[model samples]
Target: MPNIFSSLKNAYQLFKHIDFNQLDALSKKVDLPKMVETISSLDEKQLSAMMKMMGGNTKKKELPPIEGDFYHLGDEALKDADRELQLKVRAVLEKDVKPLVNRYWNKAEFPFEIIPKLAELNICGLTYQGYGCPGKSNLMEGILAMEMARIDTSVSTFFGVQSGLAMGSIYLLGSEEQKQQWLPAMQQFKIIGAFGLTEPEVGSGAAGGLGTTAKRQGNKWIINGQKKWIGNAPFAEVTIIWARDLADDEVKGFLVKKENPGFVVEKMQDKMALRIVQNGLITLTNCEVDEEDRLQNANSFKDTAKVLKMTRAGVAWQAVGCARGAYEAALKYTQTRKQFGRPIASFQLIQNHLVEMLSNLTAMQTLCFRLSQLQDQGLLTDEHASLAKVFCSMRTRDVVSRAREVMGGNGILLEYDVARFVADAEAIYSYEGTKEINTLIVGRAITGFSAFV
Candidate 1:
C-alpha cells in the first residue's frame, strides 16, 4: 500500500506539469475534475490508459507582453532617438523611482538619489536654444512630461518647476549676459531653480493680484512678501521670484539666490498630493537682489504669462500620464486577480470598466498630442492649452476613479499605484489653472467675452 501511494503521488505531480492548453482542449469534451478524481481512484493500468488517450501535441500560445499604451501611440509617434530616450527614462522610473516613490509620498520626502541620473538625461531646458540645452521640439518636452507624471506626479512637478517655470523665465526674459551667467549651469542641473509666483493669499489670481512688492534702490532691488506653494524653493540654488514693482507698478522677475541674507524658505507639510515636490513658503523680507539678477525682459505680468503658457501645455500632458498610469495599473490588476474561479478581467462588467478607462485615456493622449503640436508650431493659444488642461484633468479624475473602483478594496491603498493618481489628480486640476479659470479662458476665446473678474 505504501508503494502504491508513492506511485500515485508521483503520477499526480507529473500530471500537474502537463501543458494547460492540452488540458483545456481535453476539458472541451471530458469532465476534467471528475476524470481526474476517477483516475486517482483507479489502478495504475487505468491511469496509464487515460494518459495515452490524451495526445501530447499541445503547444503553448505566446501572448504579447501586457502594456499600457494599447494604441501604440508612443511607438508610432516618437522618433527613434526620442523613443529610446523615453524608454530609458521610463526604465529609470520603473526600476529606481517607482519602487521608492510610494514610501516617500507617504512620508512626504523627496528622493535625492535619482537626481544625478535625471540630470544626466540632459532634458533640462529641452526646448530652449543654446546654453547647454537639448533644443528639442516642444512635443518632445511634453512627451517627457507625460513620461514622468506617468510614474510619479510629484517628481514631474519638481522637474516642471526647475526646467519649465524657472529656466523658462530666464530663457524668455533674461538678458544675453543673464542667460550666459545662469543658463549653462542650470541646464546641466548643477544649479536647481524655482519659480515663486503664487502667494499664500493669491493662486490663480497671481497675474492680476500679486501682493509681493519689489522696490529698486540704486543698483539693488528690495523684494518683500511671501510666496506659497513654491515648488523646489526649499533647496533651490536660485528662485525666480515674481513681485510687483513699487516704482512702475509692473510685475518683475528677480533671481533670489538661496544664500541671500533676507531670503527664507520653510517647507510646507501635510500636503495630500504631490507631497514629494518640496513645496515651500518663501519669505522675502528686505531681500535685495542685484540689478543683474532681475529678468531683463520681464517688464510686465504679460511676460510671466508667456512662461505659464508654455508650461501649462506640459501640465495637460502630465494629466494624461497620470491617467495612463492608473488605467494601466488597474488593467494589470484585473488580469491576475481571480474571482469565481476566473480572472476578474474576463468578466463583462470588469471589461466595461477597462474600456471606459481606455477610452478616456486615448482621448487625452490625442488631445495632448495636438496641444504639443500647436505649441511646437508657435500657434498655441491660452485657450488651446486651457481646453486640453480642462478636458484632460477632468477626464483624468474620472479615469482614476474608475481605475480605483475596478480594483475593489485594493484601489484606495497606496501600494496599488491607482491611489496616488486619484490623489494627485486634484493638484493637477487646480494648478497651472483651476478648472473654472481654464474653462473661462476657453469660453472667452470662443465667445469673445472675458467672464473672469
Candidate 2:
C-alpha cells in the first residue's frame, strides 16, 4: 500500500477535473474504492496516458429526432389531453406489445395476456355516447388505432373488430334493450365481440350479394350460412353476424353468442399476414336467434353501411400506422447498420429511400387526420372514407416496400419488424374495402355514375 498522504494527493489531483455531479454519476456506475486502489498502483507515466485517453475530445453530435410522424400533427392537431393519451398508448405498445409480437406472430396466436390491461385503458367503444365507453371523439379513436397499428396491425384489427365493428353495429342500429344488454360488458372487454359479414362466396359486393340468410320463424330467426375471414371469432364471446332477412330481401345484423348450440367457429390457418390475429371461419347451421337479439333498427343494408362507413375510417388509420412502423424501423436500421466501414444511412441512395418513405408516411398521417375530422363533423360520406382507404392503403404498400428495400435481407425477416408491416399491409389493403370496391365508390361520387357491378 502507498503512503496515505501520497494516495490522497494523487486521488485528489486525478479527480479534480471531474465536477462533483459527474463524479457522483461515475461513482454510481463503478466501484470507486476498487478504481482508486487500481489507479494508485499505476505509475505516473501510465496514469498520464489513462487520463489523456479518458479526456479525449470525442464529442458525440446529438442525432435529429427520427420519428415516423414527420409532420407535427400529433402535437398540433390533437388536444392536450388527446395528445397525452396518444403517447400513453404508444408507450404501452413499445414497452409491452413489441417484444412479444414476433413470437406470437410466428406461432400464429394472439397474446391474451395484454387484453385485460388494454381493457383497463377504457378505450373500447371510443366513439359511443354511453355504456362505459370513454365517449371520446372520432379523432381520438383514429389516433389510438394508428398507434396500435404502428406497433402491430393484428392487435389493431382485433381491437377494431371488437370496438368499432361489433359495438358500432349495436350502437348505430340496436334498440335501447339491445344496447343495454351488451354494450357495457362489451365496452369493458369482459365480453369480447366479433363482426362477421363477409362470406366465403361474397366479399366486394356484400351490399347486394350476401349469402348468409336469416329466416324469421315466429319469435326466433334461423341463421344459416358461413362467414369467412372473421377476426376474433374463435375467441370472441359474442359475434355480430350479418345475414339477409329472407322475407325483406335485405341485410340485417344478428348477435350470436359463442356458446349457442348452432354456432361453430374454426380457426383459419396458414395465413401469411396478421397471423397474430385469431381469424376464423364461422358456420352457422340453423342458429336460433331471438328477435330481441336482432339489431332492432337495422331495417335494411343501409344501416349496415353506416357501421361500415365508421369502421372503414379506422382501417385507413391502421394503414397509416403499418407504413409508419416500417419506415421508422428501416430508418433506425440504416443509421446503425454499416457497410464499408460507414453507416448506409450516410449514402445518397439510402437517404433517398428514407426520404421517399417519410413522404408517404407523412401523407398518410395527414390524410387520416382529416378523415377523422370529417367523421367527427358528420361530413364523412362513403366516398370520402373510401377515398382515404384507397389512398392510404396504396401508399402504405409503397412505403413499406421502400422500408424493406433499405434494409435488404433483414427487411424480409420477422425479427426486423418491417417484414410484419409488409405482410399486414396486404390484409389492410384488401379488407374493410378492397382496392377495386373503394375505387368505384369514389368513382361513382366524382362522375355521378355507379361503375360498381
Candidate 3:
C-alpha cells in the first residue's frame, strides 16, 4: 500500500509540467492512461532523472570567489602590519578611485577631486626616510604602486611622478635646504610636482642625447628648449627639468617654477591611453631659475639615471597591477555571462585564456617581489630594473589582449572596464623604457657588450 501511494505521488508531480492540451493531442494518437500507469510504476530514481531531463532544477550555480592573487602572495608573504597596509590601500583605491576613472578617462581629464582623498593615505614618498615621508621597505612601496595601478594606471603614473621622480630628484640629489622645502609638502600632495626628462625630440636617448640646454649667467641659469610628455606639467607647482649645460656639456637638473614668465606649458591632447594624466608640452624660453633651486648634487645624467632605475621597478609593479585588473575583470565576466545555457567560463578555451593570464601575472608579481628585495639590499642595477620592466610590460600586453578577447564584443566598450585596461597596457609597454631598449639593457649586462650606437 505504501509503494502504491508513492507511485501515485510521483505521477501527480509529473503531470504538473505537462500541458493538458498537448496531453489531449497525444491521447488521440496513443494510450494516455496506459502511459501514465507505466510512469507511475517507475521508482524514485527514474522520476528524478525524468525531471532533470525536463529542466526542472532552478538552483543558482556557485562559483569560486573572484580574486586575482591566485598564489596568496599578499596573504602569506606580507607580515600582519604590512598586509593591513596593503588592504588599506586597496580599499581606498577600490572605493574612491575606481568609480571615477572611466568617466575622467573618457573625457581625457584628471579628476582633481581625488587628490585630497589619495593624500589622506599618506603614502607619497613611501620609501623615503625623512621629510614627512614614510620610511617603508621598497617592497611596500612597490606593493602600494601595484594597488594604485590596479584601479587606474593614470593615477599611479601621477603619483609616481610626484613621489618617485620629482621628489626623488630632490631627496636623492637636492641640497638639505631643497629637501626641507619641497619633500614635506610634495609628500602630502600639497604641492604637485612634475618630472621633465623626456623631451619632444628626446626620450630613451635623454641619458646622453638631451637637446634642452641650460646656460648659466652667474647667480641664475637660463633653460631653453621644449620638454614633451611631461606628466603633471600643465599644473604642477614645480617641474624638475633636465637640461644640457653649456659649460660642462652634461645634464643638469633645474627646479623650474610654473609661474615664471619664461616657462610655458600647453596641454597635450588626443591620447588614447592614460588619458587621465595631464601630459604637457613644456616650452622653456630662457627660463631663469635661482641657483639654490637647482638640484645641487645632480651633476650629470648618471644622477638622473639613479632616479629612473629606482622608479622603473615601480613601473614593473604597475604592469603587474594592470594585468591583474584585467584578469580579475575578465574572470568575473566569464563566470556570469551565459552562452548556450551555461556560463561562458565553463568553456575550455575561455578557461585556457584565464589560466594563461594568471600564469603571466604570477610570474610578473614574483619577479617584482625579488626585484624590490634587491633594491632594498642596495644590489639593484640598471639591468635588474630594466629586465623586470621589459618582461612585465610585455606580458601585460598579452594578458590584456587575452582579457579583451575573452569578453568578445563587450571588451572594447568602456562600460566593461577591460577596454580601458587594454588601451593603458599599450602605454605601459612603451613608456619608462621601450621593450627593445630595455631588452638591450639586459642583453648588454649579460653579454658584456654595449649595443647602443
lDDT of 2 by residue, 273-302 (tens): 999999899999999998888889988888
Worst 10 residues of 3 by lDDT: 54-63
What are the lDDT figures for the candidates, one per model?
0.89, 0.90, 0.92
Candidate 2, residue 224: Cα displacement in angstroms equals 1.0
lDDT of 2: 0.90
Q: Which 10-residue window of candidate 2 scores lowest in summed lDDT?
A: 54-63
Model 3 lDDT per residue over 341-361, tens place: 988999999999999999999
Listed per candidate, the RMSD to the true structure in angstroms reads 6.0, 7.8, 2.3
Clashing pairs in 2: none
Question: C-alpha displacement of 173 in model 3, angstroms?
Answer: 1.0
TM-score order, best first, reads 3, 1, 2
Q: What does the lDDT read for residue 344 in candidate 2?
A: 96
TM-scores, all models, native as reference: 0.88, 0.88, 0.94
* Residue 413 shift from truth in candidate 1, angstroms: 1.6
Off by over 4 Å in 1: 1-64
User: Over all chains combined, what TM-score does candidate 1 have?
Assistant: 0.88
- Candidate 1: pairs in clash: none
